[model samples]
Target chain A: MKIAVLSGKGGTGKTLLSVNMAVIGENTTYIDCDVEEPNGHLFLKPKEVIKEKVAVKIPVVDMGLCNGCQKCVEFCKFNALAYINNKLMVFDNICHSCGGCVLVCPEKALTEKDKIIGEVQKGVSQGINVLSGILNIGEASGIPIIDKLLGEEPKNSQKTIIDCPPGSACIVMESIKDADYCVLIAEPTVFGVHNLSMVYELVKLFNKPHSVILNKCLDGKNPAEEFCIENNIKILDKIPFDSELGTLNSNALIAARESPKYKKMFSEIFKKIIEEAQHEAAVNP
Target chain B: MKIAIPVNDKSLENGVCQSFGRAPYFLIHDIESKENTFLNNSAALSRGGAGVKAAQMIADNEVDALLTPRCGDNAAGILKVAKIKLYKTEGDSIEDNIKAFNEGKLSPLMDIHPGLHDHGGR
Candidate 1:
């Protein structure tokens, strides 16, 4: 079974929840899909990881075979190809790597070249296998890296927990597409409520079985609780804000490692997810 | 000769729009006939390539010159390829900028600005 952990906005404790659950969850394999700023590793501290560079196919123009027809320039929707000062200028940041330029080139001047955009690391953390993709800075988007990671996911019998990036973008969609269940980590703030609704809409559009895990549930009823109740969305677990856990999180340590309470909570959360997933499978089947 | 001016409104009084790509409308004034017409800058609604689309619109109109506060590199490339002389906005009012163009007071725009990622304009 595959479970994806995501949030509408960043700093909503997605990594915290995912990393803790992955460490305590039974026979779990964790994959961090947030290529832009993956921090799950900071907590997991996996050892003896194998690293591989992630590359995207960017267009390379063979000027010798070229006529200055500007056909490729006209075909690019991103305006990444430009005919400037009697030469072709490529804005790689704007390029979506669609390879339309290669096909539209009447002069046969375009060829695809691999450009390294990120790296993926495979490691083992406390008997749990972890895979992560990290995008190079100023790469415009992390969708390509995320796509590559998901496309090449290691096949295993272990229960998979995918840690997705913030926002309901193409990258986020790519992460949750194959998930059997989605765990949306949300806070109790105003922005949290707004973004949670937006992400929930996307998850619902995908028709995936999803539930909310309200992180840092404060002293009283917050906006997240009210929104979830009104929408009839299930609240899987409510992990209260703890100062000691915050300190451990700040130090890049998983709270479950030092505290028995967090360990039991993570285990319970994992068990609840499994039970719900199995129940849904049985009913849907 | 004809010129294009990015405008806040279709009228002559409104100041030139700050960015070229996402301008609301372009005021095309024909120097020979002393006649003016407004063309909606449809590129303003595009998610991407607004600069390229706007440049193509102005170029297709056969404008001799373009006046704007800023032109992104992509738009500048298209305008240059079309052989349209790009001029910097000399004043807030389109009427004044047109007068400055007639007097040869406005300098040609050369510095290329960065692309505005969104439809929001100046």
Candidate 2:
């Protein structure tokens, strides 16, 4: 079963929760889909990393084919192609990798070329297979890297934990596309409730079974908790706002592996998720 | 010499459009003929690369120079290749900018900003 951990914004403990749960779960494969800025490797600290470059197919023009037809330029909705001074000019960043230009070329002047945008690293950490996607700076989109990260993973009996990027954008949707269950990590503040609602709406729109895990719980009123209760969303677990957990996380250490307390905490959350997932399958399937 | 200026309205009485790529209309004024013509900017509604498309439109008109408040790097690159000089507008008035251009008062627009791409999604 693939369990996706995501939030509306950063600093909501997505990496912390996913890394902890992956450490406690048996036969777990942790895949970090946050290509823009992946930090799961810092905590997991995988060994013998194997890096593979990820690329997207972009159109390259061969001006020697002799036709100055503006067909490719007019066909491109992104306006990535332009004909100026009896020559065709292509903008790399503006191109969306749509092969229409190549397909529409009557003279076959346009052909697809690989443009490396990012890399994917695969390694092992404490018996768990850890994979991270790292996008190059200044790249427009990280969807290609996420596609490589999740697309190549084998579908097996192992419990896959997908750590998604922040927000309810296309990247987050791509990360959770194959998830059996989504774990929404939310803080306790009012702003946290707003962010939670965004992912809440996104998961609901995707028709995926999901639950909320409240992070940084304190003594006072928790707005996120209230929002979940009103929405009838399942409350998986609540992690207290403690300095011990913060220190471990800041030190780039997996709290579940270092402390027995965090291990038990994440273990319980993992168990509850398994049970909920099983119930969802039984009911839906 | 012909000059292209992004404008808000078809008339010359209005101010220059603050945005070049998304401007509704472009007023092409010819100094040799002492004539003015307004052409609708088709690149105004482009999903992306509006600046490049707008620059291509201006270049296609055979304009010698572009007078605007600002320009994007992608548009500037296209204009540079097209041999179109970019003169920074002193103010919003189209007539005033045209007069300044005739009098050679406007300076070259050196500060070209990076285009705003994918802002619609954010």
Candidate 3:
């Protein structure tokens, strides 16, 4: 089963939970979908097995074309093209590669050229296959790289864990679209609960089975417990607000590895997820 | 000529909108005629960091000038290519700033502050 770990806000222990889960569930394929700031590899320490450049098609105007009509500029929906002194200027950054300008250019001055926006890394860590995409600095779009990473999916059926980016936006949706189950990691805070509801709504819209992993659960009464109970969402696990875990995470170390105490916790969480997925399959079958 | 003033909101008293930061609408108004048209910047409001897109809108609309509180270097460079004059908003009032702009009270702000270099002022 493919499982996607998502959160609406950053720093809610999404990556930590995902990496530990992958380690516990050996032979699993872990995909780090946080292309903007992918930090999964920092903790997982996957050896560089494969690296591929991700490219996007951008329009390149040929000045040699006889006529310099502003039609190409006018037809560009992204405003990537402009006419200066009867010459067409193509802005690579703004181009969405829709080919609308090329279609409208009667003189055939516009042509598409590939531009490298980012790269995807595929590697193995502790027997778990890890794939992550890193968008180049100053690059505006991360969706393209995420798409390229998704395209690297193996044909064989195996348990896959996708560490999705923050927010329930298009990029996150794209990454988690085909997942069999989704695990939303949230903190027990006002902001966390608020954004959790947003992600919950998105998962519901997709009609995917989901559960919550409450990271940094306060020692006192947990507010999210009541909300989760009301919504009929199961609390898979509660990672306590431990300062040791925080320190280990900051030091680029997985908590489960540094402290044997947390291994059982992550193992239990993984077991519960598998059981839940099994139950779902049984009910559907 | 109708000039587009990027604003923080639809209301006239609201602060001028910066291309690099969070803001709502781009108030397009005529300098000589004093007529106003507020084009809701849906892209900027929803997607974040749509300064380049907004500048393209200004160019497509054939705006005379873009009055903003602050702008990033990339957006400023794009506007310059479209031949859109970039003017810094001096006062808070929309009318007052437009009047100041028309009367040549405001000068072209060269060397934008380094803080306004990127989206979210990073």
Q: What would the per-residue lDDT of candidate 3 be over residues B1-122, giving only the tens digit for each residue?
A: 87777787777887676553335677888767777888876447433235555655677778878777777655666678878888778866778888898788987767664332123343
Candidate 2 wrongly placed segments (more than 4 Å)? A154-157, B9-14, B32-35, B118-122
Q: Which candidate ranks first by DockQ, i.e. highest?
A: 2
lDDT tens digits, residue span A1-285, model 1: 888998999999988888888888767888899987898888888999999898888988877887878898778877677664456766675677888999989888989998888898989898888889998865656777777777666676368889999999888998998888888989999999999998999999999888999988889879999999999999988888878888989999888887898788888887888788777778765
- The lDDT per prediction is 0.85, 0.90, 0.78
Relative to the unseen true structure, what is the C-alpha lDDT of residue B98 in candidate 3, on a scale of 0 to 100? Answer: 84
User: What DockQ does model 2 achieve?
Assistant: 0.53
- What is candidate 1's CAPRI-style docking category based on DockQ? acceptable
Query: For each of the candidates, what fraction of the native contacts does it recover?
Result: 0.24, 0.63, 0.05
- Where is model 2 chain B poorest over a 10-residue stretch in terms of lDDT? B113-122
What is candidate 3's lDDT per residue for A24-81, written digit by digit as tens? 8867888999988999999999985799999888877788993866787656655566
Model 3 chain A poorest 10 in a row by lDDT? A78-87
The candidates score, on chain A by TM-score, as follows 0.95, 0.95, 0.90
Off by over 4 Å in 1: A61-75, A82-90, A104-109, B29-37, B56-65, B76-87, B101-113, B118-122
* Candidate 3: stretches off by over 4 Å: A63-78, A82-85, A103-107, A155-157, B1-68, B73-75, B82-84, B93-105, B112-122
Q: Judged by lDDT, which candidate is best?
A: 2
Better by DockQ, candidate 3 or 1: 1
**lDDT measured at residue A91 in model 1 versus the true structure, 0 to 100:** 66
**Model 2: per-residue Cα lDDT at residue A22:** 87
Residue A204's C-alpha lDDT in candidate 3?
94
